[model samples]
Target chain A: MTTSVSPVRGSRDASARSGLLASRRFVSVLGWSCLVSMALLVWLGLSVAPTDAVQKDAQRLMYVHVPAAWLAYLAFGVTAACSALYLWPRTRSLHYDRLAGASAEIGVLFTALTLALGSIWGRPVWGTWWTWDARLVTTAILFFLYLGYLALRRVPDDPQVRARRSAIAALVAVVDVPIVHFSVSWWRTLHQEGTVFGEDRDAQLDATMAWILLWAVVTFTLVYLFLVLRRYDLAGIEEAADERQLERAIVERRSEAASSVVAAPEPVSVAVGAAPGSAP
Target chain B: MTDAAYVIGGWGLTAGAIGVYALLLQRRLRRAVRSLPPEERPPWA
Candidate 1:
């Protein structure tokens, strides 16, 4: 004896249940972790960390700004790697294409955040809101380059064509990342070189503040990972919808063609002599 | 503006930007999941 099961009900049940952290549970865990870590970071960064001798309270902005800049680099790096995987013949797959697109989008968001935070941090420290410094200019260029890459992905085309072209564009655009990173050193610039990894390797930040900064970086990385996962899942669902829509259109067009092919009597025949027995 | 004001503004902007983006993403995911048929809905949705 077989029992009938409602697929909708089963799906809702499965979705509601909490799975292992490797799958569905990751979303909830990551969301809660981001919230908790962010709160802790704010407290540690603002209240606990000692104010800088020169920059004072404004130095606190470094915690978020630096992490954001790092996350941007990380996201773009992921995009480039995924794009390469998608482009290579052996490992080419739609999964890599979607992952590349997702990472690039998140990268753009973080890049925008990095720029804004840098400006905010700069206004008090650097005595200017905007500058054409090497670091700032390179970062801005990086942002726009990825923005253009995203626009390329949106142009209506076959999936494979879009993926192939955008993969190349992603690779091209990622070249700005290292330039942005080394811009402070590459030119006479208003932005200071990295204190942690500068030519003078002695770190400027004290232990507590340094630890908080490190924690913030890790927290932001987790947040970036969470966002990328969610974005990738959304891409899959949206792509599936597109595929279904295309399938429906094909079926509709086939039906319309079939109806059009149905035979019709000649107009001059007058319905085949009035059905052969009607009143003349 | 004071340095404290700048710090607060930067932190606030970070929180707000991330919060808004997450909310928007959740909405988009829900919409996409709903558009697909029951049989086609992703298990994680």
Candidate 2:
């Protein structure tokens, strides 16, 4: 009768199992697509594209540089959104905190790549590897801000307390992103204005170069998506393990208390029986 | 360095960083999965 009312497996657990399988399938497919697209993108950018009139073969760096920049911006944007969701009382979930952290990790990696690629491209063009240009400085600051956000996440504290503090920090750091984006136009800086925005971009880049750049952006975005999914899964597993450890500690403490209570009962009975015999 | 060297260096570093990170993530993920009980393991694991 009890077996009829209760199934061998929980409905919630079964649903979670199915969901995990579906997402795994999706991530694998996306990972393969990203790999194949990147292979084609590398060949197209490195071998087939025409040399720039000014930058020469060094111009090929643009393929990776532009895409890295875009992905960094995108990753931080997602972080900010997830952070916002985490802070809102009605909508808050630990998953939002995990998502924000995962995105920030990827964001930091891409931001580093942006700086490195920019330095490489600049060395051949601007004749120096580093500069105090508005855009460059702002971008460097933005990188450190997110880097600090990652560091802040490491401070040991209560889970809810840590998540709240990190979410606030994330929101504050994201303000630097807009500043980084507009630093070129807002101030007379060494970095050129965006090649593809607010200007005659079509005339600026050859059609083939533009197509290849778009492909690179799309391919890298897929790579970003894949990495975040796996990273978030890792975060979830770690959190679950932490919870299990806490529960086990509580269980062990409770059992110790129960054993101590049972050991005290014999002494109490002897004392009571001795008092009654003495009174008689 | 020549322009070709600069080009190769840039692409090489990007690919190398990405490949290393992917491997590390995969390794950590496998360890995390292995630590879990069979009933609690994720579907992908």
The best candidate in terms of TM-score: 1
Supply the global lDDT for candidate 2: 0.82
- The second chain of candidate 2 has a TM-score of 0.92
Question: Which 10 successive residues of model 1 chain B have the least lDDT summed?
Answer: B36-45
Q: Please give the distance, in angstroms, between residue A17's alpha carbon in candidate 2 and its true position after superposition.
A: 12
**lDDT per residue as tens, model 2, A1-280:** 0011122121223223212212677878887987898899889989988999888999999999989999999999999998998898866766677789989999999999999999988988898999999988988998999999999999988667888899999999999999999888899988888876555544567889988899999989989988888788787676666666676788999999999998998987888777654755
Which runs in model 2 stand beyond 4 Å of their true positions? A1-22, A198-203, A264-280
Cα TM-score per model: 0.90, 0.88
As for candidate 2, its clashing pairs are none
How far is A212's C-alpha from truth in model 2 (Å)? 0.4
In CAPRI terms, where does candidate 2 land?
A: medium
List, residue by residue over A30-60, the lDDT tens digit for candidate 1: 8899999999999999999999998999999
